[model samples]
Target: MTKSQPYTQADLAKLGNVLIYLVDRLGPISKTKALKLIYLVQEVSVKTYGLPFFNMPFLVWRLGPVAEDVFVDLSAEEPVLLANYIQRQEEDCKTFIHASQPFSDDEFSDNEMEILALVAKTYGSLSAERLVEVIHRPHSLWYQTARENGVLDYLEQGRMTTTNFEIDFGRLLDDMPERKRMYTGQLDYLEQSRALKV
Candidate 1:
């Protein structure tokens, strides 16, 4: 989609639940780590299921893939969307996120829940800086998008800038030819269906 899109109330609730789930499983986490974990969950879900866990658009930021709205909400002094589900606390000069409410799986499918657990188990223990390094690896979607958008060059030149490049989720299928074919076919069907709706 575009670099940003408005999330419906249902969408915000689902995102909030997911965040609470992560916080409950991983213990209190940094905003950076929580954001990266969300990205990882999306990445794994796309690669394995041929769809994203959430409809949220990820931007190729300097650290990694970031959902701008979630980032802003988490950083806000009073979070509007996730205020009921998560709370931010400052300790040792760093902000940590905690679950303010019990997580509900109502918004997730069985497969989605599995993927969430898998991502938490796989990357939960890593520090935010470590997660950043992981996402920066060659061939990672964030790395590829950032490189294409000149964010990498900007960093190499030691220039300070705010770059928000949309990460192309379709590229996740590049290495899987069969999956790519299937994914494209589904996309074609979707386009046709939308056209019919018009």
Candidate 2:
């Protein structure tokens, strides 16, 4: 609504909790790995400590290649921040976004918003194994969550399920002049027209 109020601290906590919930829901995460992760996060942030916006992209941006160095305790060969790094650019609250680009103030579509909400809910909570469970089919048949081959079922569903939200979920796309229609609309201000302007 208003840029004056940033996301509340409580919102962050809820988001974090939701992430944890999603992970657990998708889990059979071993207690050992979970505990190890908790401890490792606590430990590793030590050197990279006190950085205000502790997003992975920011760390990687500032540290460059050094950030590629692993967090040995976690057993990760490459240390990585575990979220979909979205940016908020104030002089103080600078963060990251998709494709390493600055996010603008444009409104998101309902489905896109839902996708974000799901992600915020699912973020830090889900382990790699759990996330792979929800997002991708497990490589082994034993791991299938669906009664049938869930991955194959999902692939067939995806074929026609409007996978690209930018176009699919966007109301503006619906507002666009339909194909094979007459040129009743102007293209001057459309994003695709920008390059053509020159």
Candidate 3:
């Protein structure tokens, strides 16, 4: 395996296209819902293909799994990464995202497209709040990570906090031994390559 490289502008563009595709399929959706849907896409891809769909890191946040960079970009007054691909509108005190252009599948494989469609069809109709509930269910990555980091207790006590914890995607492999082995080997190769580079 090659050393893991930093996410590039091209990668961001692809991510923006993914957002556009999801919005096109699901119609205008709130930022929260969009983030959850993206997380679901990653989850499905990792389980099915033994690899992540994208390079974005999903952190365990109070609302569930959040891709921090995407969250920041979406909330920016003048978005950089997705400026040409999407637009956000404010209505009824909610921020809803819309696709500003047509989606292109040139950057994604057939399996990736299938994962995106699957996540949209399965979770598209659910509200952001409902998606949060789903992600917070027992044994879910966000739930497990939050619990391990004591963030769950903080949240349960009605305490306002700024705790964001890294979620271990490796945990997604717990039930699939073959996939787990492959995933771990991939990780090992990436780490070894990184060390050699240094």
Candidate 4:
């Protein structure tokens, strides 16, 4: 897909709802943390269910994997789509996003809601710094794409492609332990690449 392809209004609304759910469940989290949580939800959903979570492209942004249209909606000023659900606050030079209102689950499917809940349970308590470290692994899709082509589609390249996107856990049952460690930031990037022989 091209860089200019926009996420549908439904996708944007669902993302806002995801943000609201995360904040409500995990307490206030930084914008960076919220973005990473969303990315992880998409990543795991793709691998586990072989379905596109947002049906939108994400780029290897400097901060990590970022969905362009979602980024815009989240970054927009007051009166934006998320303004009604979330509020941004600055504390000690860091920006945090908190839920401004309760969010309903009407936008997501049962499986989609399950994925969001699983991700929140897994990574919601981690500090943003730890999340950043985990997501920026040199072996991650974002890092590999950014290394090949500079961040943000510098050469008009399409969305970042990941071999792990459709990985079959059943096929790798023997290696699941290692893979789990890698995803959880237990393995260093070099070690992960070496293990995978990438």
Tell me which residue pairs clash in candidate 4.
Answer: none
Clashing pairs in 1: none
Q: Which digits, one per residue and each the tens of the lDDT, describe model 4 over residues 37-123? A: 988887777556645455545655656576655566556555275666788887787778888778879889999899999999999
The total of clashing pairs for model 3 equals: 0
Candidate 2 Cα RMSD after full superposition onto the native fold (Å):
17.7
Q: Candidate 3's residue-wise lDDT over 99-176, tens digit each? A: 888998888999988888889899999999999899889879887887888788776566734465777787888889
For model 1, how does the per-residue alpha-carbon lDDT over 8-54 read when each residue is reduced to its tens digit?
55567778888899888889999999999989988898788886667
Model 1 alpha-carbon drift over 4 Å, by segment = 1-4, 156-158, 181-198
Q: What is the total number of backbone clashes in candidate 2?
A: 7
Candidate 3: segments with Cα more than 4 A from true spot: 1-6, 185-198
Pick out the ten consecutive residues of candidate 2 with the lowest summed lDDT. Answer: 57-66
lDDT comparing candidate 3 with the true structure: 0.79
Q: State which candidate, 2 or 4, has the greater lDDT.
A: 4
TM-score of 4: 0.69
Give the runs in model 2 whose Cα sits over 4 Å from its true position.
1-107, 122-124, 138-198
